[model samples]
Target: LIYIYDLPADYNARLLQYKHHALACTWRGFDAGNHTYLKDSVYAVETFFHEALAVSSHRTFDPEEADFFFAPTYLTCYMWPVHGWADGPWYHAPIPNPRPMHAANFIDEVGRWVNATMPYWSRRGGRDHIFLWPHDEGACYMPSWIYNNAIFLTHWGRLDADHVSGSGWPPDNYSQPVVYPRFQPLDWRRMYKGHLCYTPGKDALIPAFKASNSYHRSPLVGVPPVKKDVLLYFRGDIGMYREWWYSRGIRQSLYRLAMEDKWREKYN
Candidate 1:
């Protein structure tokens, strides 16, 4: 039987305590066992809110039957169709996309909560797959990893907006399933220099998804002080290429392109 615990009022602090205890027990077990197989084979899993997947490359949740308990208040299930592309033409212009079906906001919140709470769980498994799907009564509804993959393939497509205002490009943005890991090297700080207003990487970076201008502190947790910059690139013309560049302001370009049949064909 599985025993799950919903988080308490002071959830974050309590989660930390749980992590400490779990680690202590694991370490003691390691010492007593005198073998690393138990540690090597064991993997902790957690599910994250889908929205949080847009910003970071961590999936921190597992819905196993035994020995898995998580607080559900900070987390919620996320569900959406995995077909059609939400990029460029889709995000730029408001079209009646029938497949997106149910648009909801709980995915991101849930993903962030899990990743933040169980910081180490995502790295535990041999190859972790953070399943994303809707749920009821704090239990995941996904049947198999194969189902998760199929649903993802059906929905995979380009995003209309290159970047989100606060988060980077999402995991499913490219319309494929490939995990790219970013390790912390000494040059990590240098790599993220211009990331204040724009993502500095080749794929995920977008200048527009930057935080609002009023934000004075760095978005990352333990990073050095850097000059604050606005994330949205508001100055651009009304065209597909320019829209892709402007991030949020692409809405204007999307309208212009959609109204003109000639440009619309270019997208099709």
Candidate 2:
């Protein structure tokens, strides 16, 4: 694995500080109890990959000798404030709108700089270059040109035609899915867009790890499971203000069902 050092000085030097601000802005009054899944997911993969690279004897810094080029871009960390808190309460009156376009622009600038300064990008049209874009919002707003011929690793791997807009960048087999720790069960209706549960060969579905307790055994490990008294249990955000049409429909239906006394009795 070969890592590219193409970002500006500020991004590299103050990375931890930027990440802290981004997380704080994204989750207002965020506490140690309420875990931030997006933040944990990004850092988990980054830490693991870096550790693997460190121990790997095959790793190379030289582009010519490297088998695959890795762009060490903290895209999720940088774009979190823009995507997660732009229209939220954190970015109210007098604050400049955190446009999603800014994320794309940042990526474009990095790509341009890498192409101009490095010879590898042009050598193979970036076919062998790999980029990690864990955040769903960032992945959604990523410019097509950057990942046209490159491999993109992301958490949001829903490859529905509805997601494809003017970007024309539908995440095909090339786009690998890095599955984060899902607290909820898989919803078939929700996974219809990409057939995420069924299509294991198309994209990689990485297993989830406990961020808080890494050394300890998983909750599901080596435990005699309890009886299933309840037929069904569902809990999550419903009818979000800016959610998609299909998502809103599903959430609304679930919310309605949960509210109905008859439905609850039947399930019980």
Which candidate wins on TM-score? 2
Mind giving the per-residue lDDT tens digits that candidate 1 earns over 1-268? 2223333432222322333233321212345558532221011111222233323333234445333232332211111111132221121113222111111112323344555665433544312322322211111111222222211111112232332222122322212122223321232112112212211221121121222222445555544766545233332245454424334455555566568657446533
- Best prediction by lDDT: 2
TM per candidate comes to: 0.19, 0.54
lDDT of 2 by residue, 141-201 (tens): 4555565556666655555544532211222212322222342133212322332211223
Question: Which parts of model 1 have CA positions greater than 4 angstroms off?
Answer: 1-66, 69-105, 123-268
Give stretches of model 2 more than 4 Å off.
3-6, 19-58, 81-98, 162-215, 218-268
Q: How many clashes does the backbone of model 1 have?
A: 25
Residue 194 accuracy (lDDT) in model 1: 23
